[model samples]
Target: MVYREMETDAEMAMFVKCFWMSDSQNDEGIHTVLPDGYFDLIFYRIDNNLNRIFLTGTWTIPVDVPFTKNTSHFGIRFKLIASEYIFRESIERIIDTSTNLPLHYWNVSDETFENLETFSIEMGRIIERFIPDYTEIDRRKFSLMGCLYDNHGDISVAELSERVGWSSRQINRWFNNQFGLPLKTFANILKCHHAYRQIAQGRFIPESAYYDQAHFIKEIKRYTGYTPKELFELKNDRFLQLSTHDNG
Candidate 1:
């Protein structure tokens, strides 16, 4: 089980959220014990086939992204939206795949390996098949999601609609129905996420984490009640970092 985050090709960067690769061993997966509000795109790449597994789940309130825990069911994760979007709504409701139907995950309960494997196979097929409708960039929502991530969660619906060549109102409706939040709210989550990572990766000092160390503190406070020093994980972040036994 190896966890990594890499930069994507510039054109794909905004939506891609850094490609994630997971070679799950007999026992390895990830279950993020996130802060109160969070969302991420877990792009499953199996045997070189790439597809998206979008996860929108909220953290416990107080907005403390306490830690990331990679489970025994090994997998990879691509953090999404920085700090703007909340995952609670999406996890509570089911989002459809191509058909826009509700994705009732409960139908396939734990221990239902057969059904899970079948779905994974089909997902790989969709990525490899690359039919016209499933082209990577064609998924307008992902493109918009990436934009939100890249912009640190400050993009407007109009900008996303224009980029995707869709009507603003139409995109707004779809974005709301699909992601459970207007594009802007989700983007706010990403901004917070980006700031957190900056602090996490040591790129920014605790004193330098706030908006110019002064402005935007209120918004920052909304997500993380304290400054970067309070939330920053010293020693390795307990959750996302992992080592593999079978040479992962």
Candidate 2:
């Protein structure tokens, strides 16, 4: 498989993490996708022809996705705030799964997948049209999310609430309603995602947030079904993200 990614600019950074594309080589295979606490809007194709478009909800655990020979995918990975200001709908119903979106949802065409650079620019325009006014975003929610990403989900729920000036009860309720998961679960996913990046870079040690090595191992296994060492080994390309990360 061949994979590539492009980072978003500052203007779109608050709503999008990155734009990525993947191509299945000449053989059918399974791609193990790890949880990164982000949702996606995917445009899938076969033989370079637009097949379909779909929206994915936030993932809490790894999912194995199968691809046919010569298939390709282009996707936009979104932050939490996009649900309110960009997509403007609740994703709670699709948690851990995805639903097919109308092919014309974004007026997507076969031309949109022609190249990553063009796709990235086009998506920025699309997202901007969805939220012409930046103030449509809630200040407290924006601050809370910024802090979470900055700290890699290291802060506690209470501290997050106090920092954002929002109550914990309200925060949890909002999380559950929007993402079908609590704040801590999402935070843990982000924390585990950071650990994956470290492991991919050939670092085997646990992060400082874990109580100890054993605690870190358990948490890694819980979300990724592999200990840090196993993930680092990269046997048979079991983890697709780590396998293609450098290629990206």
Candidate 3:
């Protein structure tokens, strides 16, 4: 597989995490997707054929994604706030799964995937135009997302509420309604995801994001269905994100 990723600029940073593309290179196999606390809008093709689009909701657990020969995927990984400010729809119903979108959803098409560089620019323009015109940005929710991602979800719910000036109940209520999970669970997924990068680099011991080794191991297994050791092996490229750690 050939995977490439591009982080968004400061202007779009609040909404988009990155734009990524992957080609299976004629190798057909299954890749395990571990939750990284972000949702994605993906455009892909198999056997170099028709362009297909899908929107994925926040994941609470691992999911197996199978790809066929000549498959290429292009996607925008979005921050939690995008659900309200960009997509403007509740993703609660699609949690742990994906929903198909129209072929030209957001005016994205097969031609957009012709060049990765152009794709990035075009998508950024789309987001730039849409968010400012159609959506009302919420400062509290935006700040909350920034804190969560910046801290790698290491902070407690109480602390987050205090910092963002939002009540714990309201924050979690928003999380469940928009992302289909509680704030703590999403935070744990983010924490575990950062730990996943460390584990991929052959570091297994618990870091600051975890309370201890036991807690670290439990969280890793909870989201990934693998212990740190297993993830380190990256057996058969099972953990897709780990495999792309270098590129990421």
Candidate 4:
């Protein structure tokens, strides 16, 4: 239930958004819903002279309407990145091309995410360097789909390769260059994300029947170090892990 808008003078044309909690029953995480990651970063344009970004993260349940609100912002998307160089190197890094430490963005603040919020002040100053006209990314490189997200956990590099018309090597390169990780890493991220989403939904049914009776058993086990019953009980921490800069 988080909605944000960038009307600031320096905000980009597109915005970044993250949906941690939602009523979506499709069981798709950010990568499946946005095909990029659990958290989405986008540009925003305004008043013919201003630009900003809508960076966000959110949560969803198992029965919410499909993209009924902001998280599904116009059904937009980004390319998939595995290691998530963004956390290591964010928008400022791209603009400054410097590997300096202490970077905070959107809401990701942690030694894990980016050294906590202590550097927010510095990040604000650095953000000013982003000009109004950076460049438009290729739209074709992304996708948005709320349906079929149920199958995201099973999707592999071979599947994505065919869809993107890329070889496995090329896909790996895309992950490292665009996201800063390898393809397998990204896939593992997605797997864990999907498992967490299902775990969150366990509130609806009997915990015992949920995992064992479902097909997500092994898949969930692979990503997360827990069984379905354990997942339901420990859903909070699992989701917290997902929320902590772990984009699908």
Candidate 5:
């Protein structure tokens, strides 16, 4: 397994988290992908030619992906708000699904798509052509999202309402319309991601985010479908480990 990640350039950082690629020839069997409140554009190839292009939407549960021999994957991990710029359709249509991408949806020239070498470089070009100017984005919403991220999804709805000067109902409606989930659900996903990072690093503390040990275990299980111990003890968990490292 050769897994690596590169930070997005300044221009693309507003909507993209990073560019990641993996080349694994081993028979690692089934690898589970955990929910992390983000979307991904994945390109998989078996022997250098594109085998499939998938656009994955936000997930609230774990997904299992089977590894194949001599397969390589390149992906663009998009930020939470990226769907607003990348897709014209409602996000609710794609939640928890990996939809195949039509060639027309790529918004790139056929020659450019065929010549895709480095995903990071090619993604930058695609984003440059499709995304609107950054200044056009809602700065207030972006700032509120930053606050939520900085706190690792620990903030309350009332507090967020006050901070954003919007009613809780309004915020929930907007989030549902754009993200296909309520604000609280999105926050819980982020919290789970944060907790997973702590667990992956062997530094989890019960009191860090939960009321009690039982609550911690239940929440972890709710998001990941596995107890912390089982998740940690799994040996063929390269995808889980990579998601934790990259998303953290």
Candidate 6:
């Protein structure tokens, strides 16, 4: 198994976290995928032929994926704010689902779709053509997201509402409309991600974001479907480990 990733171009850095590709010639069996609070546009291939192109939605629970030998995959990991530009409808409609990207979704040419190697090389240009102009983004909401991220999701809804000059209800409405989850849920996912990194690094201190040991365990289980000990003991979860490292 080989996994490679590159940071998004400067122009797209605000919306995209990174672009990644993975190739594996060995049978990896079933891999567990944990919730990471973001969505991805994924391209899959086997034996160098296009297999699928789809958009994965935000997830609140773990998912299992089976990997066969000689598989290759490429993907764009989008920041939460990019939901408006990537999806045609309310994100709430696609939570915990994978929707095939129709022709109209990206308006990409068939030639581009058929030739993934070339497409991967020119991904930045292809993405730029489909991405909405940066000026069109809602700066207020973007800033609010930044505040949450900067605080590692430890900020309260009331504090977020005050900072954004929106009521808690309005903030949650926006969160649901854009990311398919409430503000509190999204924050919890973010908190879990932070805990995941700590655990991955072999440091499992109780962080400020967690109310107590029980709360930490609950959030970990909610996102990963495993307790901290179980997840750490998992030896067949290479995909999950790789994904977590790339996200970090």
TM-score of 2: 0.95
Poorest lDDT segment (10 consecutive residues) of candidate 6: 238-247
TM-score of candidate 5 on Cα atoms, chains taken together: 0.87
Query: Per-residue lDDT tens digits of candidate 6, residues 101-202?
Result: 653445544455333355554677766776776687666777788887777788998888888788889888888877778998889888887677667754
lDDT of 4 at 87: 38
Candidate 3 has an lDDT of: 0.86
Model 4, 192-233: lDDT tens digits are: 554554455653232332244454565455444456567566
lDDT string, candidate 1, 35-137, tens digits: 3223343433333333223453433223222212232121212233322231222332422221121334223223322233443433333323322234423
Q: How far is candidate 5 from the true structure (C-alpha RMSD, Å)?
A: 3.1
How many Å off is the CA of 131 in candidate 1? 6.4
Error of 2 at 94 (Å): 0.7
Predictions ranked by TM-score, top down?
A: 2, 3, 5, 6, 1, 4
After superposition on all C-alphas, the RMSD of every candidate to the true structure, in Å, is 9.4, 1.6, 1.8, 13.7, 3.1, 3.1
In model 1, what lDDT does residue 218 have? 52
Clash count, one per candidate = 32, 0, 0, 42, 0, 0
Consecutive 10-residue window with the lowest summed lDDT within model 5: 107-116
Candidate 6: segments with Cα more than 4 A from true spot = 86-88, 102-121, 235-239, 242-248
lDDT of 3 at 136: 58
Full-model lDDT, candidate 4: 0.36
- Judging by lDDT, tell me the better candidate of 3 and 4: 3
RMSD of 2: 1.6
lDDT of 2 by residue, 1-248 (tens): 77788999997899899999988869787878888989999999888888889999998888899888989999999998889888888899999999998878888767678888888888878888886485566899889889888898999988998899999999999999988999999889888988877777777778787888899999989998888888878634767677655422
List candidate 2 segments past 4 Å from native.
244-248
Please, what is the whole-model Cα lDDT of each candidate in the order they appear?
0.41, 0.85, 0.86, 0.36, 0.74, 0.73
